[model samples]
Target: MARRPRLEPRETRLDATQAYLGRAADLAAEFAAGIPPRRIRTFSEAAPDDLRTALAILSEIPDLGLVVHGPRGCAVRAPGVAPLAVTDLDQRDTVLGSGEVLAETVRALDAAYAVTAIAVLGSPVIAINSDDIRATVATLGLELDKPVVWVRTEGFRSAVPATGGDAAADALLQLVDAEETEREPGLLNLLTSTRGPELAALARQIEGLGWQVNILPAGASVADIARAGRAEASLVLAPDLLDLFAEGLETRFGVTRLDVALPLGAQATTAVLRRVAALGGAAAPPAPPRSVSKPLAGRRIALALPTSWGLATAELIGDLGGDVAALSVPHLDRSHAAALASLAERWPDLQIHVGEGQGFERTGFLRRNALDLLLGASDAVAGALRQGLPAAVLDPARLIGAGAAEAVTAAVDSAFARLALARSAAQNARPGYTPGWLKRSPDWHIKQEVR
Candidate 1:
């Protein structure tokens, strides 16, 4: 009754190596030989933990209540986070056990809210306390007559926040029961972690090709999830976050998992479409040639992005006549092997920095490079701006499908146009690190871990 899929962090499960600094060719070569290089940071600035990552995915399911079993402080991330009912484990609860509190919270949430399923999420406190979440959830599911699941996630399990996505994927898989369902004709599951205008556009693009699109694990109902196994194939946009779910679908329900490159650049969009359309005996129309403005003409740029976005958007950068000087990724694993190999075959000498939110390393890397611009998600971009590097916000949502070139160019052009602001900030803004530290090599604090 308590059968739960093992939800280990990416470090252990995926063998994601921490390459604090490396070159494209060397990393690709090592990985090609089935060797994953691991590194350790003597000093880490910051990294998003697994707990939040699980929350972000679980909350996206329609009418699913997340019971974040932790102290009041853990639930405080709820402001920007989704609506989660906290166990509110006080000192007494923590000292004795929070199992009762978690059960009570689940019951209360079920009573107060309209949730088809309630997930008892673990926290650092509960993880440390060794609470039996599966038993508690199993019991609640019977008592309440609802789909109750345990999402085993801890606050400190992984620095690679995306590992939490794996935890959520395993939990979500339990809710799916498509073994008996009749397979729908040409039904393609458009799996995504995004639910924005871009997602709608992507769905339409696929739908226009005469396939029934069923978006799941994000803005999908429990009934929709239950029928996910009835689909012909599951097409995942970003492998880093959604691949695990697709793999689960394949394993559990025999749903075909199409491991296509993310449709970021125009070429990728065409490739993704052709691959997916082929499943239904249909041919994808070729993408029209984009009018490249070359906004970043002859500019050398550094991008700090996730594996999927970094690999895809790097093509967009090149399409805009920009040279990708360096790629700063959050983590690296076998999932990145093919793309890393491709990048190596092209930009053999390109610098590759793999770590989570090490601003000190970024400061040194930026200082030592002759990059004209820096682009990344908000946090990394903010760090670059503070250090007086010309940086821009690289919203991954806006960079999907055929608009990748335009979206990237707009951001890069804006960063260049705001050159005065960057210079002004360079003179007035605080460096946030000691000059001595900045002077040292970015990988100075990185020591190879002895396996």
Candidate 2:
């Protein structure tokens, strides 16, 4: 068992380190060189799409409005759960400038919603035109009483989708008052995306310890985000997604961070609860013995999931008698290095693929490997199912606590039970891709450089 690092107050930028964490140094090196075996599809979401993620995070706060300063299409992407407005920019505005339109949009949102705070998000069009959204918001702030924050969402400039989330966090932190306050003991900021049953289950576990859980981003109010500075510490659930956000909070608010593996499966989850309890000065509850199911014995499983979930799910699958044949992570960075190293220690021979939209490579792997189960994101599951493989979409948020583990066990058993039916459907359906083409090297499309 890996010993947990002691929590310490420090001033450091987490993103200053490499993001990709993997035991296989060679594979990480290959990905860094941009010569992975297969080319993947480009992510369609621009930076503004992060508004969906940002709004989801901010949704916990009541009556907070988001003003998207771009085309109407941009506003359409914003989840309907929150009050939103769009600048409705067109060709004329793009050629000229949309500053006036943005000011009008903010004014309209202010009049329309009784929100405590409003976030102004820039779209790809604004980024392309290099519109000074910050300046516009600043000019409006001079007159508007409510705080107006500008979140940079320049999707065309970066490939990483989470960059927009980081931008939102940074902008949101600006709204947080820096004045020191008496630290609230046993108060923790749970920096993660938790929804539905998982949120309820995890909340019970944390609250059961007599500690207050403040879930950030998801469902967090503007006040909750601002008050995060007053928490005893911040516990990160999705380190890969929120490490930079946590770092920002720590730097600006003096709130220390507990960087631990995501709570998945019996052991990892136990570790998380115990650590948080200890940090909150509560007694650590005795962990129940883990129950392993033998249904997956002798089975090979492949995973395509977010970084933290991918690592934790691998452990759960292993406990359930499944051997992880391969794993696909969206992206790797410095935040993931420790987890990657830990995974490497456990599965030295594991094949790790890092990229977004690597359906081609996944298909190729499914063709070559005698995999019994394919668990991953919806796109990956669809690709595997088309190839007649029994697959399940791994929604990490939905898979929490021991109940979630059991649910996954049941899901695997059910998928295997219906394997024949899935196979028959695949056989009857028109094949999406030719077998010969799939059998070809994933690098087939690439022109090799000769020395």
Candidate 3:
């Protein structure tokens, strides 16, 4: 008997078992309708990478109005962008979580920065129990009569710098907007699971709904998140941060959330836009052809990132107008299982290549297939480009909506377009290839290229 050739999904169809439950479907529907998007920012220990990322993000703030806490070492040099005051946490308090020290730091920071809100970063010895440390900050915020949020994240080694900005951005949303922001009349928060450049496009889609967007740490301020209370609603674009934010925000502010897979393809983007419009109590806009759901008769693509990005990336590609070529996630942990299962069920014929630390085989597979587009680690992308394939890096900072989606979409489209224009340029120059050390395993690969 002859074996059947691989079959890619027609568009995207999950088995009955994969369909969302009542509430899940309802929320997903609402998200497609249109809801208010929240603003976010991060607070955590000041690791080197964290500091660098913080500086990179903070520097972009026209007026650096952030309030920081920690020791003198807590402050990193933000070139050309400055003008914010940072409180030094000092040596003793660094290892030891001290209310007194934090109180003092908050007082100084509040007095100096007198800015919108405050968020904490991890530092020194306090890294231990950093998860619970936000409560301490809450107490301080209440005392200082300040709006402050604390972010807790593990430091990324130079070998693989984690997506600190994305994580930090997640925390920022929790800190500032969790309390004050009332859902706007009609808008949605584009919560992304994987941080990458494509965020810009997603944000633009939300804006198309006619609601205000506050992109937390990346494009929002303390004042913006505080305004969430007035927004129409919120939407979750990314899965990882979805549950965490959805549950917390729903309980705290009675804000409803529409949790859906990341909208990557034309179909998915259109569906997402419809959901956003519905939630806004308006007719869904005439979605552009480039939107995920349209014009994707049948195309194939590859998903090559850490395990963290596999499911989300696949969803995006399938939604747009493509099929999976290869799947390369860093590990085969539980997080990967759900994502893999989702894609596998949806696209039974597609090859879901799981890369468990064996970079050579995975790289070689991508090189050979040279799928339509590569979405994963920089190295894997480079491998594809080496074979004269088209590739684009994922950047989370670009995801923080704030009406940046059009530019982001243009960038993604242009990047892919350029691959055709300068196939030789990327191949010979190898400009897109990121070293293994720089690539964040799974979750952070999209933005590592920017680092």
Candidate 4:
């Protein structure tokens, strides 16, 4: 079993916020890189400071533009926001169905801005009545001559900003089939929702084996994706996005999809390079000396993420000679419980930790353990750090499985290696790391010293 971290109280409020946002930024980058590139229209019920942080991250997207929608039906210059167009819906109009108002707003943007696509940023107003916005857009012929994507971020402060980027990217990908063209053979299109820096490193590692790659939702074009059939094969990354495009490719273009795990270790990465080489009809280079060594032998790890992700992490972690420890899946709705149950039975030793209120808290517990390798969110890593334990963050936002286990494993392994180095540094630098409560309560510290 993976050794859990020592128990401790939660960190200070500031550290929690910093850790949360740090992870949020990584997720935002993932959405920016993986989803189709386009403009964004957002509706928020967040405080001014929270909104500013969200906007700061949105502003950093060179390819994505943001148009803010007001809150509480107010029509004023939002504090800290520069002048931008606003569409205010009064209470009467909102109650009476503001479809017309929304349609007019979209039409105005269509004619005024060069919007290639549109996504109704999910919020209370929209989530409660998304059908209204979609119907209004459809009814008024405000399609923007481009794809419209809907992302749900109901009642979320941080999740909204990142989900907005994801919606934009998904909307962009949906527009790919709209283009008609042919791609040259040997120019394989990457069928991932995203290709972040770590993912890009995996791509480069694959390229080093002598294959040309065109990452979708990143540098790939609609024409490129449409012509994916011409490529020898498609590497299915995130099963959700991969299935979406893979279905289209098979139906329209006759491309084969390779269902594999997202690679994250030495063995996993090597498997991916081997697959790419085999497909491209090239020979893989010799295995790295370290891979054959027992570098990850007997290491125990635990993972927690949306059930949208498979138990692939458990398998990959276990394959590396690590104990699965415990598997906690939150939001294991009826749609996903069967799959979860099967995996749990397969890895009986893996503990099943479910969360309260449909949200996964196992991820939090995993971080608290400070296991040899922890895969979860940035907050999970931060939670570990607050207790003086180092962890590797397996952010679904920043990393995706391009071709399956081998492909994703390679990217994850690279990230894990870097994280391992950072952890080593922290451990060496601070011999007596103190918990947050001890600092906040001076009396507690004095009493302990006296004892």
User: Quick one: best TM-score, which candidate?
Assistant: 1
Local distance difference test values of all predictions, in order? 0.79, 0.68, 0.48, 0.44
- Best lDDT among the predictions, by candidate number: 1
TM-score of 1: 0.94
Better of 2 and 4 by TM-score: 2
The clash count of every prediction, one per candidate, is 0, 14, 87, 17
The RMSD (Cα, Å) of candidate 4 is: 14.0
**Model 1, global lDDT:** 0.79
lDDT of 1 by residue, 311-374 (tens): 7777677667788988888888888888888878777878888877677777777777788889
lDDT of 2 by residue, 183-256 (tens): 77777888876566876688789989988888876677777877888887888766655676788778867788
**How large an RMSD does model 2 have?**
6.5
How do the residues 1-451 of candidate 4 rate in per-residue lDDT, one tens digit apiece?
2332221111110011111111212323323344212211132122323233233322322233234333433223323222223346455644454555555665675566554444333334443333344454344433455544332222333322222333333333444554444544555555654446767878787777776776664444434543465654567564432344555565555555555545545555666667777777888856644433333556566555544453666655445455656544432222233344555555544554433121223333443333655556554455444434445556564434333334334534654666756566556644222455223321111111111
